[model samples]
Target chain A: MTSQGVWTPEVVADLLLTAESSRTPVGSVTGRWPDFDLAAAYRTQDVGMKRRTARGERVVGVKLGLTSPAKQRQMQVDTPSVAWLTDAMELPPATVVPRSRLIHPRAEPEIVFVLGEELAGPGVTAARAMHAVSAVLGGIEIIDSRYSGFRFTLPDVIADNNSSSRYVTGSVQVNPDGFDLALEGCLLEVDGQVVDSATGAAVLGNPAHALAFAANQLAERGHALQPGWVVLTGGLTEAVPLAPGSHIAAHFSHLGSVVIKAD
Target chain B: MPTGLAGQHDSRTAVLNAEAAERLLAAYAGGEPAEPVIERHPAADVSDAYAIQRAQVVRWIAAGDQVAGYKVGLTSRAMQLQSNVDQPDYGHLMRSMFAPEHVPIPATMFIQPRVEPEVAFVLSRPLRGPGVTIADAVCAIDCLLPALEIIDSRIRDWRITIVDTIADNASSGAVVLGGRPVSPRAIDLRLAGCVLYRNGEIAATGVGGAVLGSPLNSLTWLANTLGPLGVTLEAGHVVLTGSMTRATPVAPGDRVSASFAGLGSVSVQFAPEQQEAAR
Candidate 1:
């Protein structure tokens, strides 16, 4: 173990990458790192993302976390946060999740925004942000926290890339034009039983607003959301822990549905 | 006595028919005031009022006037109280309703005209509702602008009821949009302020929160209300949210301007009736 408050961004990034690849849980770095804030966590994440890029993994887009007020309150955070997604993290819809490779995995329902144009913003608005969207769809995120007991502070989670493991997008693609996304209702089921249900409004009162928040946040890092990128707006309901041989399905009103099986 | 009672019922039915609605709309299009529809048909409900308004809009569209967008009226508590109606009303906006900023408007085009300062939304994407929210509305908007809605009452003597106004397409007349287009993100719209000027003097001042808490809420209400009716607020459509203050009447030669804190200003002059012939 490294000395307290002495770990560099490279050291932190390597530790996280090693934990993920070896399917092992790691101790929380929050107490050990001096002045470890969101900015520092993002720097560690950037280093890890760069390493992934060097390993033949291409970034697809981003995933938002704690966008819903309830989720924010549950996490004791006031603002939404983000994580990176890559092509290697995609799981085909209805495909069984690789349970052995994940530790204490959970699933969440999300509204996906597929960009049609580049979206950059220091000042992004819900309306202006939506102009770049090509389509909307339903999605499910499989989050596997590398921290023991799924415990961590906001900075700790940020350094872990918001616990992102894999994602599955629905087949149905709908033009977002004229669709009342706020009112888009969703139902999440496990083992053919309803576990959670919510509307798109639950994601920051509107999924587009969540997308706008993501764009503004990305702009802080001198990055822009590029076309063909898929953004998961965040979980609309409380995430449920995944179990072996359990099947999950999320039904989104107007946008259709997505399913995942864990084995 | 029985014969007289039957005659009254026949007259009521005729007054509620499509022909009566068309005749009333014709008077409106001709800029001629007529008897209030409620006086003619005392039992006309809100749905009947909407039917009459729809009939007039169909005729306007047939006459080559494109549907520009829609508007929400009586959203302010003051307007609702002044109008003596508890609920808000809506109307259709025609392409002709748009007037150039800083231009003179023909006084002969309306019988009894009034001006109200308003906030306008330009949509970048289509919005349909039964469940639209403030966030959804904000995302659908492209920009915001200062506006003035010139409302005209087609009913003679300005004696109108909810049904009468509704049948008159919520008394929609014309709109003057400001030159400046501001992105919705730059300002806290609920706190946006405006000052109305008549002849370069302050007439009234109000904030965006006056319109049902915020203008975005008004748009949300419109989307949800129009969604089930098979109407969609399309991209590029301009929506006039209800006025922020009580409307002020305008006469020939009157110059009215309204300046918004961040949206700039829009002005219009009611040209003398004699100038109508020259144009």
Candidate 2:
């Protein structure tokens, strides 16, 4: 340890900055933040970034990340991770993005819920998270990172907002009542080619459960996902990569389809 | 205010102000650069971070930008480990992020780009309530399909604090869905195999098990998680489970394909840079 026997913020920042600059994974950054434990380092970095966001004046949304079993298994954890959101990043349906500025871009069709009320911990359940949702709809998530070459560790990934980028939705916004997410199926098409099919069950059995898990997780952190907040359940299927001048469409067996194009 | 001709005003100062505002908005949208701002105010308190983010969101919405939806990240074990979190995080998506299918990618739009194979789901009924079960979730789905997600990021050197990512929408880039659908009950999703082919060669191969062992299980977890949060899974919505296999990167001129057992397959052709430039 340094003479103080405690990790210093400068050390943590410098290590993190090096990792980011080098486009190395979080595992590598760990080597630099010797005194700063991985999780503790994350918490410290989180606090610093949160302070920055607050100083700039932004609105906080629910924390995201931690919806994939593969991720959990890889991380050797049972629960998912999350990051706060501000109002500024919200986009409308069918928004177009330039391909050049993004570090690495990919897309996923997801079920999004907009909460009507705030829910907290103490018995946070999947069903309860569902009840808090005001509407559910089909959406496309465009995931991007600020890191060049898109290299980072799990810790780095979470710290980077789970690599969240942009999103678009379909016109049909419906009240999530009596929906059978698992049994439903979807067809993803690129141009006119028929490729890829799956069911809602692919997303951690049911997407509602993912949302519920996120809600309770947030509650444990003393941060409640308020009403009117938006929650994106895990992806129903694997993510699709993007290219310029491409047409991406998702047609659900019952939910209809949402389409977008790269310009 | 001093009554001065519009042209006579300090155009440079006004320009600087506008530029500063734009940066502020972007910082608000994403996270502020870890570097200290010129004014050098004391560091912000963590508790107040959300408030500031929310206010900026309101301003963006008021500016006529559409509220597309949201994105969940760090939900996967790999990501959680990489990010050093036990749970997932989330962010919002805007309309400006959408890209069409089969469109040639312009290399200039992204600092870097990569692709992943996935499955997308569409719901037929709403799945809500705190006690929603797997069976209940099963009954709510309409169809599922093979898909691809293009993940990109905006941070320089990919170095960003967590809050920086939170403001950036989880580094989401674009999405492409295949033209096929199937029922969840008809196949063994957990055992299903996914083969990712790049340029007619196997670059990566995995199974449904890779994605939490059956994408449905992921959804079930999501439902349970959201139940207490007052959220629900509605009909006519879509969900993207985590990757069924390891993420394999693709480049221009690379033709990619993913085949799933019983569910079907999807593919995309990366165009030549010159061809993309022509577009």
> lDDT per residue, candidate 2, A1-263, as tens digits?
23334455445445443443454433433334444444664564556456547558364454345555555666666666666555544566666655554545777777677888987776777788788888877777777654445555565565555666566767777777887665455556666443344555556656777777777766665677788777777665567777787788766544557787766
lDDT of 2 by residue, B81-144 (tens): 6666665544444555545557755544554456677666777887765676668768878888
- TM-scores, all candidates, are 0.49, 0.45
lDDT of 1 by residue, A1-263 (tens): 65564777788888888889998889888867757888889998888889999999999999999886666777799889988999999998888999888888999988899999999988999999899999998999999988888888888899998999999999999998888676565667788755545566667767898889989998998789999999999997679998999999887656677999898
Per-residue lDDT, model 2, residue B72, is 48
- Those runs of model 1 whose alpha carbons end farther than 4 Å from true positions after fitting are B1-279
DockQ of each: 0.01, 0.02
Docking class of 2: incorrect
**CA lDDT, candidate 1, residue B235:** 99
Model 1 lDDT tens row, B1-279? 699999997676655857547767777668778888877677787788888888888888998999988889988765677778877889999998899976788877888899998899999999999888888899999999889999998888879888888888998999999888999998766545566678875555555666776788889988998999999999999999988656789888899988665678889999976787788
- Candidate 2 ranges with C-alpha deviation above 4 Å: A1-28, A34-38, A41-45, A48-52, A55-57, A191-195, B1-279
CA lDDT for candidate 2: 0.59
